[model samples]
Target: MSFISSPVDWTTWTPVIPATLMFIVKDGRILLIEKKRGLGAGKINGPGGKIDAGETPLESVMRETQEELCVLPINPRKLGELWFSMGDIPDILCHVYRADDFTGTPTETEEAVPLWYSLQSIPYQRMWEDDIHWLPLLLEDKTFLGKFVFEGDSMQWSHVETGVAW
Candidate 1:
C-alpha cells in the first residue's frame, strides 16, 4: 500500500488579513480609494494594501500608500487595532492609524481611484458593510478594538461599543 494516498482538498474559505493605513485630516475628511477590481470592486475604502514580509505596520502603510495612491501620510498615530472576518476567507487584523498631517498629491492607480469624503457624507454604498459599524468611533478620536462578521461583501453584524471619546 502506498503510504501517501491523501486526497487533495481545495474547498476552503478564509479571510485575507491585509495591513491598511487610513489617512485622516482635522477637517474630518478621510482619503479613500475606489476599488477597480477584485473583492469590493468599485467600492470605496482607505488607501492601503497587503503587508509585506519582514515589514512593520508603518512601513507597510507607507509603501502601500505610495504604490496605490502615490501620497505620503504624515504625523499619523497608531490609534487602534481590529479583527474582522468575512465568511471564511481570511481574518483581517487591521492596525488602524490616524494622520492629522500629510503631504503630496494622491494619484489614481490601477487598484483604485483616489477620493476624499467627509465622515458624515461617507459613501456607504461604496464601502464594505462593516465600515459603518466602528467608523464613527474613529472620527471621534477614540481608539477602537472590535470584531465584525460579513457575508461576502456585506457586513452581517458586530458587537462593538466605544465607551467615551473626543
Candidate 2:
C-alpha cells in the first residue's frame, strides 16, 4: 500500500485532543526529554502535554514544561501548529513553541528525563519522524504549519507550509 494515501478530510473529522510542545534552546543547545510515561513514552521530544480545560495552548506548554522538567519557560514564542492523524485514532492538534528564556535549571522528573543536545547533533532517530521535517525550520527561527498521517508510530506522510511565523 502506498504510504501517501489521500489527505484526511478535516471537514468530516474532528481533532479531540489539543496538545503543546516547547523547545528550549540556548547557546546552540536544545532541551529534550525521554518520556518515561504516557503517550510517546521512550521517545525523545520537547517538554509538553495535553491542554487542560480552560487553559490556553501557551499556558499548557508552560505548565507542562514545569511539570515535566521542573522549570518554567519564559517568553515562549509560537512556532507552529501540527495536525496529526492515524488510521484508527482520533486526530490531534499540537501547538509548537520555542522558548529561549526560562527560570531555574531543568531537572528530570517522574515524567521525563531531561537532557540537552547541541542543535547540530539532535538525536532525530530517537524522535518522532515528523520532527525531521519541521525542526530545521524551527532552528532557523521560521514558522510553519504541518500536517501528517501516521500508521502506528511511523509517519506515513507529511506536508509542511513554511514562512508564516511572523
Candidate 3:
C-alpha cells in the first residue's frame, strides 16, 4: 500500500492558534468535561481552551479549568504537545498538562459538565479520534510530542515521539 502525505510543509508551517488541555487526576480517577457548546461539543475532553494573548500555556490551562470546571488546578505538570492540521483549515497547537491536585469544587458550568472516570476506563470512543493514540502514553507518565493531520474528525496521518518527562 502507498502512503498519503500532507501537501503542507509541516517543517515550516506554524500553528495559527495556541490552546491547552489539562487532565486533573485524583486516586486514579481523571477529571473530564463533557462540552456543552463550541468546537468538539458534546464530546468528553480535558478542561482547557485558547491560550490568550500574552498568556503562557500554563496560565491558559489554569484559567480555562477555572472557567469551565470552577476549580483551580494545583501542581500541574507538562505532559506533552499535540500539533494538529487539516487541509485549508487553521492549525491548532495544543499543550497538554496533568494535575494531581487542585483547589475549589468541580461543578457544572455553562461550558461543560464535570465528571470523573477511572484512568483505566477513559472514554476514548467519545473523544476526538486522535486522543487514543497519545493519551495512553500520558497516563503511563511518559512525556510525548505528536502531530496529526485530519479531515474533520478523521485522522489521516500521525507521528509521535515518547520520552521521560524532564
> What's the best-to-worst order under TM-score?
2, 3, 1
Number of backbone clashes in candidate 3 = 0
Q: Residue by residue across 106-129, what tens digits does model 1's lDDT show?
A: 888888798888767888766776
What clash pairs does model 3 have? none
Candidate lDDT scores, in order, read: 0.70, 0.89, 0.89
TM-score, per-candidate, Cα-based: 0.80, 0.93, 0.93
By summed lDDT, the worst window of 10 consecutive residues in model 2 runs over 1-10
What are the candidates' C-alpha RMSDs?
A: 9.3, 2.1, 2.1
Off by over 4 Å in 3: 1-8, 164-166
TM-score of 2: 0.93
Clashing pairs in 2: none
Q: In candidate 1, list every pair of residues with a backbone clash.
A: 13-88, 14-88, 14-89, 14-90, 15-89, 15-90, 15-91, 16-90, 44-126
Error of 3 at 43 (Å): 0.8
Which portions of model 2 miss their true places by more than 4 Å?
1-5, 11-13
